[model samples]
Target: MSYVDGFLLPVPKKNLAAYKKMAAKAGKIWREHGALDYRECAGDDLKTAFGLPYPKLMKLKKGEVPVFSWIMFKSRKHRDTVNAKVMKDPRIQAMCPDPKQMPFDVKRMCYGGFKTLVKA
Candidate 1:
């Protein structure tokens, strides 16, 4: 089974383009460092009647959008190894030129690592 890193964040609509650009670069870096897959999806259908909608789940404010993202690895150890290298990559530094200048509010971002229980 594979390991995964997941992220959920709120980004203002006005910054979506910038955010996408950053994510694309980040995905490339992760891939180069051995990530099996990387995906960053913007919220299109945020409302639902049966459960907590993404907007609500993220406590999104007016004009802010929700983004759900993930990266896959061969296993937990592989994920750690890849991430360690990725953190030190100059590509990552270039991707995030200034943490203080990031597109969205870092305080609102939620992230975690997971051990996949099942895969199809």
Candidate 2:
């Protein structure tokens, strides 16, 4: 079975474009580094319980937007190995000018290792 690393975060509405750009760059780098899939999705067609909005769960303040994304790997072990290499890849490091300016809050980011149940 495949493994999926899922992420849900709140992106500042004002920084959405900048964030998308950064995500696109990272997605390409991740794919090149052996990710099976790298996907970034903005807030659209989202539905939550009447009292359980996504941003509210993230403790987002006023004016933020939700961005749900994930990266897929062949398996959990593969995910671990590829992530380690991606972190150390020189090409990826070269593109990171300021780690402090990352589009989303690292502390607020949520991720989980999931086992895929079905696939077409």
Candidate 3:
């Protein structure tokens, strides 16, 4: 079974472009380091009557929108190996020397690792 790392966060509308650029660079690094897949997607239609909407769950501000992302690996061990290299990558360091300077709020970001239960 494959392993995956998921990310969800609220990004200010004004910084969406910058966030996209940063994500693109980060995605490239992950792929180079052997991640099976890397994807970043912004919220399109968040309003809904069923379940907790992302805007509410994330406590999105007036101009903020949710961004969902994931990185796939062959397995948990593979993910660990690739992530270690990505963390040491110079490009990643250059991209965010200080977590405080990230385009979005790191404190508000949600992240988790999951084992694939089903894939078809």
Top TM-score model: 3
Give stretches of model 3 more than 4 Å off: none
RMSD of each: 1.0, 2.1, 0.7
Task: Count clashes in each candidate, considering only residues at least 3 apart in sequence or on different chains.
Answer: 0, 0, 0
TM per candidate comes to 0.95, 0.85, 0.98
lDDT, model 2, position 82: 90
Q: Candidate 2 residues 13-113, lDDT tens each?
A: 88899989888888988898799999999876446657777766777868778888999999999999999988898877866667667777767878898
Error of 3 at 50 (Å): 0.7
**How do all the candidates rank in terms of lDDT, highest first?**
3, 1, 2
lDDT of each: 0.92, 0.84, 0.96
Candidate 1 clash pair list: none
Model 3, 4-78: lDDT tens per residue? 999999999999999999999999999999999999999998889899999999999999989999999999999
| Model 1: lowest-lDDT 10 consecutive positions | 91-100
Q: Model 3: how far is 28 from its true place, Å? A: 0.5
